[model samples]
Target: AGGQYRLFHRADLIDLLHWAARRAGVRVLLLQKVREVVPGPEPLVRLASGAELCADLVVGADGLHSVLRQALNGDEEPFFTGQVAWRAVIDNPTERRDDVTLHMAPHRHLVTYPLRQGRQLNIVAVQERAAWVGEDWRQQDDPEALRAAFADFAPDVRALLDRIETVHLWGLFRHRIAPVWHREGVALLGDALHPTLPFLAQGANMALEDGWVLAEALGRAEAIEPGLAEYRARREARVARVVRAASGNARKYHLAFPPLRWAARTGLRMAGRVAPGMMLRSFDWLYGVDVTEGSAARSRK
Candidate 1:
């Protein structure tokens, strides 16, 4: 089990969190859409229904189009990264849940992995295009369009695509990591702080880390300002590094030049065969981190 990567289905994970949070006596509210957030000594959250809530501190875990992030930083648009992706889940007859696989070609790539105890396979197909697509991932796209994008892919990949009857499409867009993470009673969390490309598969993980580090920082601080500042200091460098690394991944998969692509693949294959441990160890600083220990130590005098 050492040096292994684990994957979880998003919906299933959310359900688990709901159960855990409620078990811990945390009230879980749904369907109350937020209208705006006002940050100061005491933060205020105004819901669209005109219901208002006050908190000693407001944390924006609202994700990419976060209303709170906009509240703090004002309006700024995230530029399209010239890429779009479609996500779908299909029945996995083969029970291929053990590992993720990637199929790459010029300007496009298909990433597939098993989910839900290998009863289903999750597919994410991405391609480079100049056209602007909406940032919404819930926007449905024709299944045929999905097939056409990877028509020339390996037959196994094509067959998996054939099983996708429903797919949602979204444009990949990046916003600069918010210039500020916390202001008085408010702090940004997760994608609200930084929107990362899917390449590193660390977007959700980063958010989880944010929660751990932020909470630990606050627990050890004398005041909210110092705690929030420490949380940002601990997180910003690691997050920026992650975002930069992920941004470079599209180039690796979408290599347009045949020779360049071959060389890259060849080098990877060689690394896999010769020094696989070293290659994986390169990510040790990332995957090996124990935020509990790090945050506790850093929070100490």
Candidate 2:
């Protein structure tokens, strides 16, 4: 969540993109897929719709199973994380609060947050289990499946599940970070470079961070080569750390032992009670990073 208002929404993200692109005099083409990348001093992208575009630097913002990443790194498959995510959005009638509420239960966790100015709430519930075979992100799942999975959760939480019209289920997957994010004039961005689990809720935020840093990096460079290098150097280790942390979070949130579960919840309550900003401060290193200034200072030195 970007925290633009009290809540975050997909529509808000779209609006931000629309405004930013227009201000930059950029137009985006939707529903077009890149078919191939011709790698060289200058890379050329061949689109499936028989279009060719050439750019000085090609940054792949595509999600998991990125074709650009495949062409650049010789096609690697994403490994399933042995968990499935059931996600949906329910109508938010005016009374819903604007904070994100996360409910953790045995072997599962649920996160709900308002979207569209608290007019709706997006719910994503993840469960750890076996036999989810594929990495397809758009697999359809019935709402009953969600209800059954989360039956023992809090009553208020169960009420939200009842309101879901439909649900999408997908096997969570993880990819090894590309050893190289840049090759000549091409590079990977977002999920292409590091596909993360939803455990940390940092996947989309990381992409936004990537976009912000990337645009700034490109704008600073006198040439594209150093720009790509600088971008990878600044982002690679940081994104990798977040990916690992998200994986660890999944393990922590889904502990099956009763003693462990109670301890974890109790600790969170104590921490939240002791210092609310402590949690916020722990993540300050992430949100407070100034990539442009860091890069500029490094270059000057």
User: What would the TM-scores of all predictions be?
Assistant: 0.96, 0.90
lDDT of 2 by residue, 160-242 (tens): 89999988888888788877788888888888888888787777777877876777777888888788877877788789888
lDDT of 1 by residue, 192-262 (tens): 99989999899999998899989888988999999999999999999999999899997899999999999
TM-score of model number 1: 0.96
| Residue 279's lDDT in candidate 2 | 63
Tell me the alpha-carbon RMSD of every candidate.
2.1, 3.1
lDDT of each: 0.90, 0.81
Candidate 2 CA-lDDT value = 0.81
